[model samples]
Target chain A: MNRAHSKTKRTAFVVAAGLAAVTALAACSSSSGNGGGGGDSGPVTISYGVWDDTQGKVMQQIADKFHESNPNITVKVQITPWDQYWTKLKTAATGGAAPDVFWMNESNFATYASGGVLANLSDKLKGSDIDMSNYIDIQTKAYTFDGKVYGIPKDIDSIGLWYNKALFKAAGVAEPTADWTWADMVAAAKKLTDPSKGQYGIVAQSAPQQSYYSTIPQTGGQVISDDKKSSGYDTPEAIKGVQVWVDLVNKDKVSPSLQQMTDTDADTWFTSGKAAMIFEGSWAAAEFKEIPYAAQNANVAPMPKLDQPGGVSNGLGNVMSAKSAHPDAAWKFLQYLGSKEAETAQADAGIVIPAYKGTADGWVKAFPEFNLQVFVDALKNSSQYPSSMNSAAWQDPIELEFNKAWSGDETAAQAAANSAKIMNDALAAEK
Target chain B: MTSQLVPPVEQGQRRPTPLPPRGTKRRSLRHGDRYWAYLLILPTAVGLTVFSIWPAIQTFYFSFTKWGTFGGHEWTGLDNYAQVFHDPELLRSLWNTVIFSVMTLLGIPLSIGLAALLNTKGLRGVGVYRALYFLPVVTMPAAIALVWKLIYNGDTGILNQFLAVFGVDGPHWLSDPATAIYAVGVVSIWSSLGYNMVLFLAGMQSIPGEFYEAASIDGAGPWRQFFRITMPLLTPTTFFVTVITVINALQAFDLVYLMVGKASPAIEESQTVVYLFYAKGILQGDGGYAAAIAFVLLALILLITAFQFRVQKRWVHYE
Candidate 1:
């Protein structure tokens, strides 16, 4: 009787303990930030959100200038890495508690702009000395939607061939020139590849957007038609452009396998000297410069042209949010950013190739150890990434199949055909 | 007896005894005692409403409306639900989630094995072993995933290097689609093993020693004792663990999201249901569709839980 009573007590104790354990787990998972808003209208508590790790200084300086002009305004710079920035911003936006101003990108700008999340800056910049026309045409167009400008153009980044000077000498190859054609690039990559040493000729992270998207224009293919209803998915030129990277992996054996690339990010691989060359945007210049080896050996050159020239050498532009509460202040901040003063500061920081025409001259002077001039000349032939309604939805499926094609799961022709259908279906659905 | 009957019967009776009723004082005392019991439960009841119940109701309402940027609601009934049904990506994610849950379920038997081992008498360092095993459970998820990611690296990871000794090449565990889900599921299982083991250990410890002592006296082997006595008695703990584990697996998000992000080539094969909802609600700003997906998830969880409860009647040994 005593043993039976103890057993019953033990069972009840275990049940109660388990119940308590489960409840504690639920409480820990659900508890989050208190719904506390920051102080209301004190010192102009502007939270400037940005994604780039290297450009924080340039951004800080811009904020400092804003503070100088309006002594009452206290700007705080918040840096969210590129990957987490968009997701966090969206969460904050839905909560009606987003940062006062956050950096925007072309891919996400249209969605946010149309969703009534951004503050319209058109009227604020109307009679100001900002002179929006002074910025690049494509840069302004990327942020303008429904005849309203939602973002101020901060900077521009176009792709360029960043080569290792040491690798060129080792391969007994001459430095790439202003007029180097596609044939020249392939030959140089072939010479530089050395598998025994765990080195590859080029590091491309196996993305159509990163490696093949811009190259499509070189092969005389448009990414999106004028109507934006049809895509350039199945065009022979586009397929040919994509095959260049695939051949690099399969035929030339100069690029890492899809699995190898997946294991190691392309930027890290290039900076570590595992790959002698890479197609990189000006945005990476800061990161590249920080790598000890790259600082000593790397130099930028314009992207190789086709045999007859005239391919699209396009790039991405930075945008700002439209639903920003501080429209006047944000616009004023953007105007200062667009000014030669801000562009020069950015160049000196080795942050990016300024979109303003003359600003890159200072970039070359500031970073005299590297050849930054090549970036300036490269922009002449550059085109912007396609901006059509539903591009994000369309690109989602297309990019997935393209990756499969590169990994040998599907042939290039089959992948392209399938993606074209997916793209077309998405576009049709949008209509 | 008089205290229980007098209060109710007196209302119908024309007249009570002129003397003080025998049960009146006891009945009033009982009422006061029950009121205090309710007061004791008040804090917990209020907390549940403010936290759990309110959020659940709000999530359901949010599903039927499109959220404005500045935080107002505009209802668009069934539009979000329609979109969720048509989304191939969401469907693929659900399939992946089921696969992950099954893979994680394999950890249950493994935990039982550990529990049985730890339950052994005269085992030295059992406390130390249990604490070491539970290390992953207490560590932050991001830290755990990162360490696992390095170990799973194809070129320089310790796992691949160790495989080289056996004349085998380890596949890219985190990057290869064929093995990525299993690889992540392995981490999930590893991290959760210790917590589950402790529960099992506690349950095994609770079983009366006399049953095992009697079985041994009757010449039963260890396996026989486990099957006949220990297994039967540990059923309640097993039921609770299984329900919690399945629910946890269905809601899997952090490991997949952090280790294999959307831009990853392998993401197509790795995304779970919550990851899909995150993409729609947070990434793509389709809150309505995201909310619809959430409701689908809630329905799935409810149905599965109910099914588990129904099945428990056949197998669960309460005694």
Candidate 2:
């Protein structure tokens, strides 16, 4: 009995020893528990968070330029992938330790803005050298709420029909023009498809910004109502828009199945030369130009015309945390980020379309090989990326059922109706 | 769980007595060793109370309220729980987790078989064999899942390519609702086999060699010695492995997150309760719903563990 007792006691002591080491390490953290993010006025290394790694070089250049002028403040660029960025930011903001400055998008803007986590930049911009008039109206409106601006436009993104000229030439199909209609696109896709090569003519992606979002609007349906109180997914026009992709995938067999797209994404299929065409964002130009085949043969044209001509217009903004200790330094950094010089740098990299007016020339010339002007031309007739407060509440639920339509388990109308019901509940919850 | 690292004292022919009840009339630690013991344990107790127990209380409180953004919430008694009960997706995920736990239990016996084979007398090159089996346990699960995803790919994977030689067509394993859950279960079994085998090997090594020799001398063959001696003696280790494996399978998320991502068509069939909690809490920003899901999972695990403890009295033999 005494032996077993000694054994238990010995085990306890060993565990206690291990835990002691952990506690000592925990105590070694230099800062106390209650210190906030960027809570020092001394030489500070402010974390500048972004989602896209393709623009990491340009971001570093921007940071270097800022360091040269400020000399005391330093910025470190932290890249979190797009899929995890919002959730990570949400957790940090809820814990009251959000990064000083980070990228923001319209899809996730209202949640943070209305939650009082974002710093109001209206006062900061009032006396700043950055001209608000130089920025696009749509992007400025996206970053504003109740007469308070919480974000400064970083870059704009618009979708275009990126196609392979070599494939079109090989298939004896003419290259698509800016005024091409939906029928012309279908015919070209049919002509370009080569089943023996294990290749499809087009990849009909389910991506909101690149595919159905633009197509729905072109078919004379708004994703969100003007009052932002209702979803138009239940409308016949919206059903027709969704049906376009379904037909391309299941009926015509010109596009890969939904399952295939899930395995290897549309972007990969296009860049790998397995798909002749794709609806891609302007930001992908930098990534595609890195690939040899795509760099040589890929070119862009405006999204084809249907009942109406449009594409999804989305832009990213730089937002400051309301809880930042160095709000003045953060504002100065944000102002510099929105300056014409920073936009020019972003333009020369061809990573993204700059939101500042008259700065798209360098972006267009960055890739002298391709017709990059298509993205800028599409923006003229573009619609805003649809979003309301708590957009994810409905967006997630809708996608849960929407995939069934793409997989041919349900008709487009049924999916749209189900989507509308769930979307309405989410929209109602936002109020 | 206490570690098996320490050598257990062999008390002859007497079962272990349960520790005396606290506050009993005995020479309690209150007299002398209590202070040192308290000092030794102070750090762990404080860490648990602050990090674990405190957050549990907060999560419980949040379960009763609907959260907006940035810690904003309003009291809505039992509303979130009501939503959870009515949610079909939650129920489906719970069922999948149950199936996942039971399916993963298949690894326990497989590991025992490997452990016994390696325990063979004068086994040739057993160390190389053991290292090969333990590789999966040491590798990162994300990297494992990524490679498995390519192998399971429908159109161009090596798995389908291999199956083609036999004139067999393989379904899209990770994308098909009928196959995705089973595929995930198979991977779970593969990944956990090494860990369970190590535990059983430790247990086997602790057994005295004379016990097996005596059984063999009584005209018992190798299979008889295994069933009569090794199996009965290994009950305690088996119990621990079972409990740990059950808990791990029930809390599975990493493999599901990596293998069948959110875009997969088979998510409804393959997602676990924890994935639902993540989607609702972090992705959808519904903290109340997520808290409720977590409490439900806790209740389930608690009941299952209690039932296991009860069932162990029938089979688990204590020295």
Per-residue accuracy of model 1 over A111-153 as CA lDDT, tens digit each? 6777677777788777876666776777777778778887767
- Worst lDDT window (10 residues) for model 2 chain A? A25-34
- Among these predictions, the greatest DockQ belongs to 2
Write model 2 residue lDDT over A1-431, tens digit each, in one string: 35456456544443333332222222211121223354456777777889888787789899889989998788888898987777677777877777788899988898889889999888878778877778888888888877788998888888889999889998889999977998899999998888899789999987777767989989998888977899999999988888888888888889988888877778889988889999998888888888899999899988888898876789998999898877777777888899999988999878888889889989999988888888888788887789887788887777767788888888989989999999988898787
Predicted complex 2: DockQ: 0.27
Candidate 1 residue lDDT tens string, B90-206: 889999999999988899989988999988999999989999988889999999989988999888799999999999989988889888888889999999999999999999999
Q: In model 2, which runs have C-alpha deviations exceeding 4 angstroms? A: A1-45, B1-32
Look at candidate 1 and tell me the lDDT of residue A292.
Answer: 84
Q: lDDT of candidate 1 vs native? A: 0.73
Could you tell me the TM-score of candidate 2? 0.90
Alpha-carbon RMSD of each model: 7.3, 5.8
True contacts kept of 1: 0.25
The top-ranked prediction according to lDDT is 2
